[model samples]
Target: AQSVTQPDIHITVSEGASLELRCNYSYGATPYLFWYVQSPGQGLQLLLKYFSGDTLVQGIKGFEAEFKRSQSSFNLRKPSVHWSDAAEYFCAVGAFNQAGTALIFGKGTTLSVSS
Candidate 1:
């Protein structure tokens, strides 16, 4: 079965520090990869995605992700972190065969920005 895993359950980064949230997926074929962020009591917001074409995909809020087929990973990165960027980050995988089915999400990584 296809699944996503976030190695870090929680990360604490100082304000303006670099951030990297790891995401790894297990699937027979290359599946759709997505990064989502959710604030407290808020809905999930799309950060970036890797469908095809480019191995490195840019996303909203100074975020970018690189798709490494060899690693089966689509890791999200940001050069500088912000306090507002603190949220629960989710790595998700969607199958091409199952169009209507919901994506498989990782447990989630909670980001805490420290001053």
Candidate 2:
């Protein structure tokens, strides 16, 4: 089955520290991967996505991810984190079927930034 996995359920980082959120996926073929961020009481916002071509993809808010087919990973990274970056991060895989495309989301990782 095609699914997304976020190993860390929660993570705490000091302000201005580098951050990396791990994400892994299992799919039959090259699948669409996406990272989304959801702030408290806010809807999900797209961070980045990987379709094809370049392995390294840049995203909004100074974020980026590298797609590694061998490792089946698409990890999100930021050189420096801000207090406002603390939010619930979700890794999702897009699955296509006769019913159309649907996103399978991981449990999510909660990021806490400390001063």
Models 1 onward score TM values of 0.97, 0.96
The segments of candidate 1 whose C-alpha lies over 4 angstroms from its true place after superposition are none
Model 2 lDDT per residue over 4-59, tens place? 99999999999999999999999999989999999999999999999899999999
Residue-level lDDT for 11 in candidate 2 = 100
How far off is residue 73 in model 2, in Å? 0.3
lDDT of 1 by residue, 23-109 (tens): 999999878999999999999999998999989999999999999999999999999999999999999999977559789999999
Lowest summed lDDT across 10 adjacent residues in model 2 is found at: 94-103
| Candidate 1 global lDDT | 0.95
lDDT of 2: 0.96
Q: What's the lDDT for residue 80 in model 2?
A: 99
